[model samples]
Target chain A: MNAIEINNLVKIYKTGTRAVKGVNLTVAKGDFFALLGANGAGKTTIISILIGLVNKTSGSVKIFNYDIDRQFDQAKRIMGVVPQEFNFHMFEKVQDIVATQAGFYGIDRVTALTNSEEVLKKVGLWEKRSSIARTLSGGLKRRLMIARALVHKPEILILDEPTAGVDVQLRFGMWDYLRELNAGGVTILLTTHYLEEVQQMCRHAAILKEGEIVRLDSVKNLNKLIQQETYVITVRNMQPLDGIQSYAPVVIDEHTLEVNLNRDEQLNDLLIKLIQNGFAVTDVHPKEHRLERLFLSLL
Target chain B: MNSQWIAFQTLVRKEVARILRIWTQTLLPPLVTQTLYFIIFGKFIGSQVGPIHGISYMSFLVPGLVMMAVINSAYSNVVSSFFGAKFQRNIEEMLVAPMHEWVIVAGYICTGIMRGIVVGILVFLVSCFFTHPAIDHIGIVIMFIILTAAVFSLAGLINGIFAKNFDEVAMFQNFILVPLIYLGGIFYSILKLPVFWQNVSKLNPLLYMVNGFRFGFFGFCDVSVIFSAGLLIFLTLVLWQVNIWLLKNGIGIKN
Candidate 1:
């Protein structure tokens, strides 16, 4: 069963601002699902709805076969959220912060404390457990958020912009930790601006534009959409176009030339043709489609 | 009494800790500021006016100071906490939680009340520095202080919900609260006012809180404290409903 199911979810603000038009998505259990979009895109809104924060205007949200409306408690039980913003008590200690989140899941104080310690260690913040939440650095604060979210051991974890301002090293560290958790059977719903992170971490992805789900597919399938592989060649000279008949039509701009190739094109043949034409190929590199370019093209 | 109550309690604890963690700012500053009002106005100004009802001028001024502490701290706690949540964009955590909307409002409100009462009690204790403290009815005094804290806290939460920037909270504090607290007959009895001004003072809802609290100390009041308590309670329920509606509708949280 899918860990979380959202169908045509819509949210319209009171001031009549339609934040999320309608989004439909399904995240299979234990799958790492990436929800990708720009700043004003409906990623946060959709995440908020799944976590039961923002009330949906229309549409059904189901978690574990329990509808959010009829079985809100059941749905809430299995969902853990790491909000994009700092949500911990600023004056609270790291341990207390994680413990409080556990308490929200009906965990007793003793177990919550034990769980907090274990999760804090998992995030490498165990040494800073006694430190106040506001006193920690930005990256540490984000890690603390992650630890707190996992304290309850929820079946599904939702992270909204989990790595927004963290340093590169810390970002990868978080991704590693999240991947480990996913391997342990925890479903993860990640919303992030860094497309590379999605490509590296998530196997399933949903692209949202202006509150609508423009595309949702397996990471492999999405990558397959750009069927023609790309290659950029910086030749010594741009001879007459007829000299290179083997290569597909090339787009030329300044010193660089880019060509689109069919999936079955032989790389060796193309390279040999360029070499024999009296033009030295300074650089010949195959380029895979980037999520950013695909995203821009969709927009 | 598990998740909902526990979450509410955790939020309240966070709120209280935020204020008490920095007692110099939360509890002490307001106490010191209220003392200046007592020294400058009650001691110096009242010596010339003489006692109002066998009560020393400083004694009469204590209730007003305590009420001021309650109202100011209560309002500031909710206004600042809610606005801080908004400013930091942290309210999304609670907004996205499985917990219901009212729990969030109540949690913030309780924190406001705790801060207000703590500051109010501190001011009440500090009043002893100037004059002998008197409590004609201990129960009434406790009830008055608690009810005052709850009412003002709810009002402050409402303000926090509607506030967009730091200035909006300040606008309510500067324009609405200051005038209301002053005209509420904090310094003098409402009956002492000229007939026209007495009716005008009656229009300020804060007058009931101040007068009701004063009656708690002296057992003497111009307005009915029961009516005041009931009215304040009604306003609190109304604000609570409104706050929950605002949250559920994503009035400010969305975007």
Candidate 2:
């Protein structure tokens, strides 16, 4: 069964704004899926509908085969949601915040405490268990939300920009933790502005534009849709680029060069030509993230 | 236990913990306020007035003061706590949970009742320092306090549902609740009012609550004790149903 399935979802606000316009989507069980969209593209609205925060105007949503309209209790029991905004009591202690979330799922106090401890420690917040949530740094607060969502041990984890304000180091750590969870068979659904994260962690992705799905495919398949890519190459020794002018090479500095590879061209061919010209290339990387380039082009 | 029961218990526990955690705000104010009422109204004011219904004026004021505390505590507890949750958006934590709407309603109402009873007891204790009022019917005392608290708690939940800001939450208490409680015969007997005002005072639901509670202490009242009890029970049921309907409809909590 799919972890999440939506058919013709529609949400028209009372203010006469059509936020979501008949969006259809599905996330397979145990798959890491990314839902990418810009602000006002209805990503949060769709999520809110799934979690019962917003009443849908029309459509069907099923979580693990439990229809959200009819079997919402059963659906909610197996799903954990990390919303885009921080929605916890700031006055609460970190431990209590997580444990209280477990309690809301009907977990006993002893079991909730145990789960809280495990999830908090995993999120690097065990040491701050007694600190008031407002006292935590922004990154720690994000981790605290993650811990609270996980304390119930949900089978499906839905994270909406879970690493938005996190530093690079903490974001990478969170990615590793999320990868571990995915490997452990928890179906993961993510929405984020970080296209690099989509390329690194998501197996499948869908891009939403103005409340409609514009593209949906595997990450690798999506990357292939980009017909050309630009790379920044750092050379060990400066040399004349007359041999590589076919690739439109631009000299950035004494050691750096910018080059573009089209659909029929290969980086190996360009590197071989540069070497034959005594360019002595030492480092090479894409100028922009592959998925980011694809996303921009699609939008 | 069932999941609904567990969820209810958790919500109640969290609410109760919050009340105790902020005892200075939740539990202490009523005690201090009632103490001032006892000293000023019971001692200084009652000294100038003679007994009514063959009971001392101070004794006559005790039950009414206790009922007033119960009403205010129950109403404010749910209004402030629920509105605070809505304001901070943490109410979504429960909204997205697997529990039924009634579970959430019961959890909040139960905690409100608990605070009401606790504050009622404290005010009663403070009253004891000024006067030694006899309990004519302990059963009626317990029944009336709980019933009145339930009614107001349900009303408070409705207020919390419709309230958009802190000012709205306080508006009901300041403009509606205070006038009703004062006119409910807490300070004097409605029997002394002129015929038209006596009928008007009877229209106030709080009068029945205060008189019902007072009947428990003195075994005397301007209205039938059974009638007052029945009115309170009826109000409780009606308010309970209203609260359940509001929650199920997601009247103000959901988009």
Give interface RMSD, every candidate, in order: 2.8, 0.7
CAPRI quality of model 1: acceptable
Model 1 per-residue lDDT tens digits across residues B1-255: 577887787677667767867878778889789989988987888788767666777888888889999999988888888988887776755654566777888888888888888888888888888888788988878877877788888888878888899999899899989988988888888777789988888888888888888888888877998998888788777877888888766676664
Residue pairs with backbone overlap in model 2: none
Give the whole-model CA lDDT for all candidates, comma-separated: 0.82, 0.92
TM-score of 2: 0.97
Instruction: After superposing candidate 1 on the true structure, give the runs of residues whose Cα lies further than 4 Å from its correct spot.
Output: A12-21, A38-41, A85-92, A132-138, A165-167, A231-245, A248-260, A267-285, A290-297
Could you tell me which residue pairs clash in candidate 1?
Answer: A53-B95, A53-B96
Off by over 4 Å in 2: A236-238
Over A1-299, each residue of candidate 1 has an lDDT whose tens digit, in order, gives: 98888887888967787778767788999999999887778898888777766778899999988898888877887888898888766877889878877766667678888999999999999999899889999999999989988888889999999999999999989989999999999999999988888889999999988888888998877876764677888887776657676565465764567777776777677777777776677888766446766777777
lDDT of 1 at B96: 47
